[model samples]
Target: MSKGFSKEFLWGGAIAANQSEGAWDEDGKGMSVADVIKFHSKIYVKDYKKQMEITSQQIEEAIKDKSEKKYPKRRGIDFYHKYKEDLALFAEMGFKTLRVSIAWSRIFPTGEEEKPNEKGLEFYEELFTEMKRLKIEPIVTLSHYEMPLELSVKYNGWEDRKIINLFVKYSKTCFKRYKNLVKYWLTFNEIDSIERHPFITAGIIPEQCKNIKQSIYQAFHHQFIASALVTQECHKIIPESQVGCMLTKLTTYPNTCNPEDVEKTLIKNLLNYFPADVQVFGEYPVIIQNMLEKENIIIKKESGDEDILKNNTVDFVSFSYYMSLTESANENSEKTAGNTIFGVKNPYLPSTEWGWQIDPKGLKISLLELYDRYKKPLIIVENGMGAVDKVETDGKIHDDYRKEYFKKHFEQMKEAIEMGVELFGYTSWAPIDIISAGTSQMSKRYGFIYVDQDDYGNGTLKRIKKDSFYWYKKVIESNGEDLE
Candidate 1:
C-alpha cells in the first residue's frame, strides 16, 4: 500500500458552466463568448486556428442564428435543468468538493446591467444548497471562458481597460450574494490561456486588433489588475475565504540532453509559469518584462496597479495538468498537439486519441515544483483524459481505459504527497461527460458517469454510471487507498 492521502484531503470533480449549462437564452441569460462558437466535425477538430478563430461577422451571424444544431454549447447536455439529479449522482460518488464556474452573462446579461438577475442568482443558491446538504464543498471560479459578449464587442474585452471596473462590479455582486455558499473562489479558469483561444478565453476578436500580440498582452495586463482587485474584494467580503489563481500546467521537457534542446525547454517552461508567477509572486518576472520591452508592447497601467497586485497575491495556487510536452530545437521535429499547444512529441510517452501525451510522472514533478517555488497550499483542479466509451448490450459502460489513466496519476500523486508536497485536494476535470471545451465533441468524453448525448446534440439525455463510477466511489471511500 502507498502512504495514502490525508483525511482532510479533498477528492472530487469539476465542470464549467458554459460547457454544461444549456439555457443560453433562458431566464434572462445573455450571449456569452461561448455561445457564438460553432462545433466542428471530428475530422476537422485538429485545425486549431479554424476551430477558435472568431470574427465580428461570425458573431453577428451567430446572434441571428437561433438554432443550437450547429452550436453544441448552446445545448450543453441540459445541465441547467438537470443539475439536481447531477449533483445527487456526484454525492453518490462520495465527492468531497466540486469545482464549478458561474456564467457571468447569466447574472449581468450584457455585463453592463445595474441590477442583478434574480433568476440567475436563484439558480446557484438552489444548486449550492444542494451541495451543502450532500456534504460537499464548493470551489467556484468567477470566470471560465464565459465572458459577456457585449464587453468583448464594446471594449474589445480586456484590451481597453474599461473591463476592469465592470468585472469588479460583477465579482462584487457575486461575493455579496454567495458569500455564505462558497468558501473557495478562483478568479479565472486556465488564466494562462488568453493567447491560446483569444475570443473564448478573453473575448478579444483578432480582426479588430492592429497588432494581435499587443492587444493580447494589454488584455493580459488588465486581467492581472482585475484578478488582484477581485482577490482583495473576496478577502474583504469573506475573511475566511481562500482565493486562488488557476493555470494550465503544461510541464515541458527537453527532447534530448543537448544544450540547444535544454535551452528551448527552459524558455517554454518560463512562458508557461509566467501567468501564475505574476499572481503568486505579486510582480512580473524580470525576464518576461524584458521580453515585453523588446517586443515594444507597453502596458498602460493605472496609478495603483502595482500596489493592488502586490497587496492581494493569491492565498493558494490551483492548476490543470493534462499532460507533459517535449521541446526540441530542431524545427523539423515531429509536432503533436497537447492541451492547446503543439510541441515535439515524446516517443517514450503514449498519447491519447487527441494527441495529448500521457505523463503521470509529470503530475508529481509539477506538484513538487509548485510547492517548492511558492510554498503555498496546492490543489489539482482539472486532470483527466477524453476518449470514446462503449456501452455494452446490457446498458453497462465499461471504461477501463479511463480507470487505468486515473490509477496511474493517483499513484504518482501519492508519491508526491509522501515526499512532503502540500497538496490539499485532487478534483478530476469532470465527473460526468459534458461538452468538450476544445472541440465541442460529445464523443470525446471524460466522465465516471456517462451522459447520453451525441456530437450534434441528439440523444435521450439519460445518465448511466460507467464502471469507473463505482471504482471512484470506492477510492473516495478508502481516501485514495484502493487503486484496484
Candidate 2:
C-alpha cells in the first residue's frame, strides 16, 4: 500500500559508463568520441558548443596526448573498477532499479571488430550478477554518448549507414551475453540530442559534412533503423524484456499569449517530439518529414527500413526532464541556459547555478502531454538537479537543496499518476556525481553520494553520503509516502 504508486513502483538512480567509468582504454577498450571531447574550464560554461565539437585535427592531437588530466571523462571517478562498492551503497538505499549504459567501445574496441571483447562482456555479466544479488533490477542503455572513435573516423559515424550494421552487431553481442541478467533495455540515451551535439551523440563532425543538417538527419535515420533492428533482436533474445526509447524532454511554453510566441513554441515542441514519435509509433511524423523536405535535408532510407521501424515499436517511452523552457518571438527577451539549448527566461521560475530553470510542475505537464499523445507506459529515466555542494568539516555533505528538488518533483509526479497518467518508474540522473556531460566538470555535482574528485580530476576517489541519501532512502522505504 503506497500513497499513489503501484506496489511494484521502481525507485532508483542512473549513470552512464562514459561519465562514471574510468579505465577508458583498459581491457581492450578503444577511444570513444567522449574521450576526445576536451574539458574546458568554467570560462566555457556558456560556450558548450566548443566543448562538444571535435575536429579531425583535434582528434589527432587527443590521440597523441596520453594525459587523463586533460580529458576528465577518461578518468571518471573510477566506477569501472569500483562498481561493486558503489552498487552496495545503492542497495543500502533500497534501490529498486539502477539505470546504466554499456560503453560500445568497451565491447567492440573498434566498430569493425570481428569478435566481441570477452573482457568487456565479462565485466557487465559480473555487474548484472551483482545487482541481482543485491535485489536490484538493471535498466541498461545500449548506447549513450560513447561511440567507438574508429567508427567515427572511418565512416563518419552513423552518417555512412554502414555503422548501422556495426551497431546491430554490437547490440546482438550484448543481448546474447546478458540475456538472463538484464530485462529492461533503452536503445539510446537522449536519442533526440543528436541535433544539439552531433559529434558526440552520433559521431558526426560538422567539418566532414557538406550539409550539416542533411548529415544530422541522415545519421538520425540510420539510428532509427538501428534502434528498431536492435529492439527486434532484444525481443527475440529475451522474451520478458522491455525496450524503450530515451528522450531529453525539454518541455517549452510561450512567454506570453501572443500568437507569434505561441506559434513558435508549438513548432519547437512538435520538432522535439519527432524523434520519440518514430520510436513509439514506428513511423516518422508527417510534420518532421515535411520540415526536412523544406530544409532540403533528405533521409536516404533503405527499402525495408520503414517496415523495420513499423514492425518494432518501443514498449515504453523514457525521458529525462531536468527543466523547462519558455519561448518568445522577441529576440531581446531574457535568455537562460539549459541542458543543451537556451530559451527565454521564465520570470516565474528560479534557475540552477548553471541557469537551467527549475520547474517541477513542468514535469507533471510533460507526463500528461506525453501520455495523452503516445498512450504508452512512461518512465522518467533521468531527473535531478546539478548544484554546487559543500562538505562540512564534520565530513557530511548536507544537500537539503537536492532533497527539496526531488521532493517537489515527486509531489508533482504523484499528482500526475493520480490524474491517470500511466507513470511507472523514476531513476535519478545520478545517485553519485560523476562528470558533467556538457562541460566535463565534476564541480557540477548531482549525486546523493559525492565523490572526492574535483573539476581538475584530483582527490582520493572516496564516496560520501549526503543528507539527501538518507532522505531518499526513506522515500523509497515508504514508497513515495515519506517525503517528510
Candidate 3:
C-alpha cells in the first residue's frame, strides 16, 4: 500500500484576495483588473471568448461604474472584515497552511509608485501576524487574477516592458516585509492562463494591442522575467523562503484511439505545460520557440533576460488542478467547458455542475507527469468542485458529494506518492466559499465552510460549516488516514 500523507505535508486551502477580499476602494486600495469584471449569467459563463474580451468602451464604463452588486468581486464575502472569524474556522479544521494572494493594487494602487501604500502593507502585516498566531503557515501568491487597473489602461498591462520593473519592485517590498512571516511564495497564480484570459491574467486587452498574438506572448515574456526576478529577490531577502511557479494544470488526453487524435492530444498537453517549462526548467521549450517563429510572434528581450530566467528558477512547482480535458483531431468531437479552458469530452469521465470533467485518476497522472518532468516538490494548490449548495432549516449541510470528491482525489494523491512523486502539499481550491474566479458568482460554491452570499452579492455573510468540514478535519487530524 502507498504511504499516507507525509508528516510535514501541508494540508490546507487556497483563496485569492480579489475573489475574497471585498473592500475594493477602502483603506487606500486601488482598483484591480478584477474590479471591472461583471457577473454574467450562466448562459455566458462558458463562452470563454466572449467573457474574456475587453474593449476600451467597456473599460471606460467600468471605471465610472459605482454598483458593487453588478461587480461581485468588488465586494467579496468581505473577507476584509471577517478574516478573524474565517481564520478561526480554518484553525478549527486543523489547517496547516492557507494559500492566500495579495492584490497588487492594494500595495501599489497604480502600477508605478515610489512607495507602497502603508495602509495596504499594514493590513497584510496584521493578517499574516494572525496566521502566525494560529500556527497556520501562510503561503502567498504575489499576483492572482488581477493587477492594478491603472497599468492596463495607461501602460497596456504586461505588454509594456516597463511593467516588468514595476512588478519586481512590488515583489521585493513583499519579500522584505513578510520575510519572517511567509516562507512559501508563488509568483503568479495560473501563469498559463495569460493566453486563456489575457484580461484576467495580465490585464491585456486584445483590441488595444496592434498584434494580438505578439502582444500576448510579449506580455508573457515580461511576466516570465518578472517571476524570475522575484524569485531571485526572495532568495536575497529571505534566504530560507521557497518561491515556486504556479500553473493551471489542465491535463489533456486523446479523445480516441486514432493516431491523429493521439498526436493532437500530445501537442495540446505540451502547449499547456509550456509556460511552466520556462518557469521551472528556466528556458523556453523548443516546441514553444518553434510555435513563436511559425506564428511570427516575436518577444523583445532586454539584456540579462535569458540569464535571469536561467539563474533564478523556482524551488518548487505549485499548481491549481481543478479538472482535466481531452483533445481530438475530429472536427465533430463533443466538447465540454472547464476553468477558463475547454476540450473534447471524455466518454469515461464524469463532469461537475460547472462542466469540469471529474477524473480523480487525472490528478495522479498530472502529479506523476509533472514530477517526472520537473523533478521538484509539487503542491496541489487548487482542487475542488463548485456546486450549488443548499442549507437545511436546522442549519446543516449534507454534502456527501463534496466529501466523496475530495476522498477520491486524496486516494489518487496517495497512489501518486506511492509511485514516487515528491508531493509537498495539498491546499484545496477553497476552504471557504468565495466568489468564483471565472464566473464571478457566489452561488457556484466550493467551500467546506459555506458563506451566506448570493450571485448578486446580497446575503447575511454568515459562515457555516458543512458536513465535509468535519470529514476534512478528520482527514487532516489523522494525516489523511481517517477519510471515513
Off by over 4 Å in 1: 43-46
Q: Compose the digit string of candidate 3's lDDT tens values, residues 380-409.
A: 999999898999999999999999999999
Q: What lDDT does candidate 2 reach at residue 408?
A: 99
Compared with the true structure, what per-residue lDDT tens digits does model 1 show for residues 152-209? 9888897888898999999999999889989999998998898887888899999999
- Once fitted onto the true fold, the runs of candidate 3 whose alpha carbons sit more than 4 angstroms away are 43-46
Against the reference, the lDDT scores of all candidates come to 0.91, 0.92, 0.91
> Residue pairs in steric clash, candidate 2?
none
- lDDT per residue for candidate 2 within 241-276, as digits (tens), equals 999999999999999999999999999999889899
User: Of the candidates numbered 2 and 3, which has the greater lDDT value?
Assistant: 2
What local lDDT score does residue 294 receive in model 1, on the 0 to 100 scale? Answer: 98
Q: In candidate 2, residue 398 scores what lDDT? A: 85
| CA error at residue 229 for candidate 2, angstroms | 0.6
* Residue 221 of model 3, lDDT score: 94
